[model samples]
Each structure stands twice: as C-alpha cells, then as structure tokens.
Target: MGKIESLDFIELGNHPEKLVASSKQDLYTLCYPSEKMPVPSHYADFVRNDTVMLNNFRSFVAHRPFHWAWFLRLLKIRGLDESFLEVPGELSYSLQNPCIVAIPHFGLHMLVPHVLGHFIRQDSMVLATGNEEGEGVQDSIEKILPNDRTRFLKLPDRWILRKLMRGYQSSHYPVIYPDVTSSGDKRFRHLSFLETSIRVPLGVENLSRLCKCPVLPVAMTYHDDCYRLHLGPTLVYKEEGSIIFPLFSWIEELVHLYPDQWFGWNFLHEMIGEAKLLR
Candidate 1:
C-alpha cells in the first residue's frame, strides 16, 4: 500500500485486431458445446510453458485425494497453530467476524471449487461463486453440493450476492473475485489492473473493514515433491486505517510470488494507465 512506482499501460504496443480475432475464435471453439475442441492456441502455450511448474501437486489438489493429509501438513507450519485450521467449525458459530481467505489463482480454478466442496460436505455449509453463477457453473456446483447436508446457492451478479449476504448468514461463505476489469489488451480477457489505487479492489478492503473480518492470505504452488498450500499470517485492521497498507503489501507479495497465477496481468497494466492519468 506504499507509494507504488507507476507503470505506463498506454505505452504497450497495440496488438493487431486480426490477432485478437483469431485468438478469440480459437478460444471460442475450444469452449463451444458438443465438440470438445482442441485447446486454444494461447492456452496451449500457457500449459506448455507453465504446466511443468504445476507438476504432480496440481494433479493431487485437482483431484482432491489426500486432502486431510494436506490440511494436517499446513497445520504443522509453525505459528499457524490450531485456530487457523479451526475456521471450518468456526463458520457455524459467528460469521460476524468472518475470514477473508485469499488463495492464489494458479491451480485455483481447481482449488477454489475443491475448497467449496470440502466445506459444504463436512459442515452443511453453502457457498457462492461469481457475481451470478451461470447454469453451467451451477451445474458444476450441484455435482458437489451434498443432498442431506449442504445447500447450493448462486448469485449471478455482485448486487444480488451483496443482498443475499446481508440477509442470510450462511451466505457469508463467499468466493469473491475482487479483480474485475475490461483490458484493452484483448489477449488477456477477464483481467484487472493491480496498482491503480495502491491496492485495487478497494471494495474488498472496505468490506473487510465493515465486517471486521481477518484477512488470511492463502497460496497453493508447486513445490519440491508436492503442491504446497501456504497460509500467511492473519491480518486485522485497526479502527484508524492501519490495515490497508499491510493488506496491500500482502497482495503485492502474492502478485510477485505467483505472477503468472494472476489472471489480471492486463488489468493491472490498465490501472497503471489510469493511475498516471489521475496524477
């Protein structure tokens, strides 16, 4: 949250419209129904270069085989202690002071869904994703939601999610994507700027202030033999703006640690441009 050295987004070389069109075409074909098309050229490149970084740990977390063992290992980290692992039990009691668990986005396409399934299965919990979950995403949620235990709810947009969170305490378990932006760089869609306001997604910070919840930084990365999930020290904001800088610093560290994991690289560049304009 300290003064960030500004980056110039406008200086980025303009990508040709034809290249953008081709990338989009390939991506669409890959996601289209009926035919499970070939992996998009762009994503194939990503997998080629970065899949090695994921290694076997990605497979384990992706499939979710030995989760208990994984959790136990995370608990053994010094200073993480008991209560950190106790959040599952804690959720049923008081969500007045909820926890903001920020996990990295690398294997997170898998990790987030797994974490949601894990909580709902064990605790009769209900979790929400995206602004408004589409039918497809909801179908994915249904496959995971337990019959006798947990309830699955989808809020397709932020407005509805906010309203539901206020009304239903169980809705407190929210999987938020704070980084949302339209990048002029079409190559990276669904990405957001990282540095516009020291910490972008100021809304999330505001929510933490209002909820008085502690922010827990979660990271899952390929390490040594397995994928490691590292939970950093808990963060709490004091009454007078004490938490923003620390929270911002924490996010910056996360960005540096897992730069490729962040889907918002292009968005961050856009925010850099906005920051310069305002100055």
Candidate 2:
C-alpha cells in the first residue's frame, strides 16, 4: 500500500443563529410584577413608560427586528473595512497572534469578530450557541459572513474550549464571547454591571491562564449608520486570580456611555435578579 492518510482537526463551534422570535411574546417568559425592573429618576421624563418594566418590554419588541435586519444588511454588504471604525487607530499593533479577543455581545456584536478577523488577517473562530435557537441565528450570519479566515464553532463546552486553548497555545486566534450566558455553569464570575450583578463567563481568564496569554476586551456599538469598536487595554495575568475585574469595569463604562447599543438591554433585567433597579 502506497497511500498516506491525513486527519483534520474537528471544529467544535457552530455559526450564530438568526435573530429569533421575540421572547416577549412567550407569556411564560414574561416578567412578573415584582420582578419588573425600575426606572431611574434621571430618565423618567424621557421614557414614555412609568416603570422600567413597561419601557423594557416595549423596547425589547421594538429592537428585535431592527437588530436582525441590521445583521442581514451587514451580511449583504460584506464590507468589513468600511463597516467598522476602531478606536485608538493604532489598535493593529496590540492584536497579536495567540491572543484571546473577548468581545461583549453588545450592539453589532457579530460584526465585532467579522471586522476584527478580516482587518487583522488572523484566523478567527467565534464560540457558537449550539442549540436550535442559536443555530438559527448562526444560519443567518454565516449565510453572509462566511469563509474570511473567520469561522464559528459550537458552544465551548469544557472539552471544546480546551481544544481551543490547545490551538491558542500554538498561536491561533480565538475570538471569544464573554457575555453570552449558558445554562447553569458555576464557573461564571458574578460581577455588578449597570448596578446589577451579572455573571461573566470565566473563558477569558481560563484561556489566558492555560495559554499564558493576555486578553483583548473589545466593546462594539452601532451609531449614525456605522459600527464603532473601542479596544480597551489588554488584560495581563495578575496575582488577584481574576482578570475579569478590569474587563468588567471597562464594559460597565461602555454600557453607561451607550445605553441603547449595549444590546444586553433586552433581557438583562431578566437575567440578573437584582436588575430590579434600572440605570
């Protein structure tokens, strides 16, 4: 026999799902009176609703379609260079190989990886949701933004994430989603955001520890018909054991600065119980 066989590594991530139906329409998922969020005094005059409950419910439904349509349009255009404007214009130097680019699932979240991967010319793999709902979103995104050195994988279970760590160990770039919530994982580090405690995935910290690499915390926003990305300082390993502290602080600042573009606004209150008080 004069034949040679080669094996390719299996990709564990999946593409992002298409924008799903509004969770607001699901009666069982609706917020209870006691659980409804509150409206801060500052925005009382601007918001038409008396409470954050009514306001959030309305905003959730209203924003759903637009976010989806925006994704669709971005896919159609496929203009990574013109679509995004990164802050600190000198961001290129800091984005080295073997780095973890952890971005918040803020407004224009998907675009974060797309633009970064294309611009930086790095091998990219975004962690996917893996479930039926998540697959739908992925289907929508991949239809437009596929095969540009940027790819998606199924949700990072312990095994899959470890594989990513192995590849990252050898200098492959894995764009991470630090804000995506999964079902009942105790490893998450709970931190306060917008005055409410939100659980953050320990992926960034764990990966950095495993590979001994720093993380690039990126925040993205959509405004005036364009996407803007702000690259914060890199998070190096520290004696404190949690790199998420500084990253969360920077995220809070972004959420505070652009309330509308924070993207998590739709279900954040539901996710965090203490979110009863709005910002």
TM-scores for all candidates: the values are 0.47, 0.67
Q: Tell me the tens digit of each residue's lDDT in model 1 across 154-264.
A: 444445435434523543444434444211112221222243342344444454566666655554544322444455556676764444455456655766566544444
Poorest 10 consecutive residues by lDDT, candidate 2: 3-12
RMSD (CA, angstroms), candidate 2: 10.7
Measured with C-alpha atoms, the lDDT of residue 32 in candidate 2 is 37
Identify the leading candidate in terms of lDDT.
2
- Taking every candidate in turn, the Cα RMSD to the unseen true structure, in Å, is 15.6, 10.7
Give each model's whole-structure lDDT.
0.38, 0.56
Candidate 2 per-residue lDDT over residues 1-279, each given as its tens digit: 211111100111121232122222332222234334444433333344556544653453344345444444444454544543545575667664557887886766755665566545344344333444554555555654456445555553546567667667655677666666553335777787766677766766877787788888877665534556788778987644467888888877776676545556545654464443454
Using TM-score as the measure, which candidate wins?
2
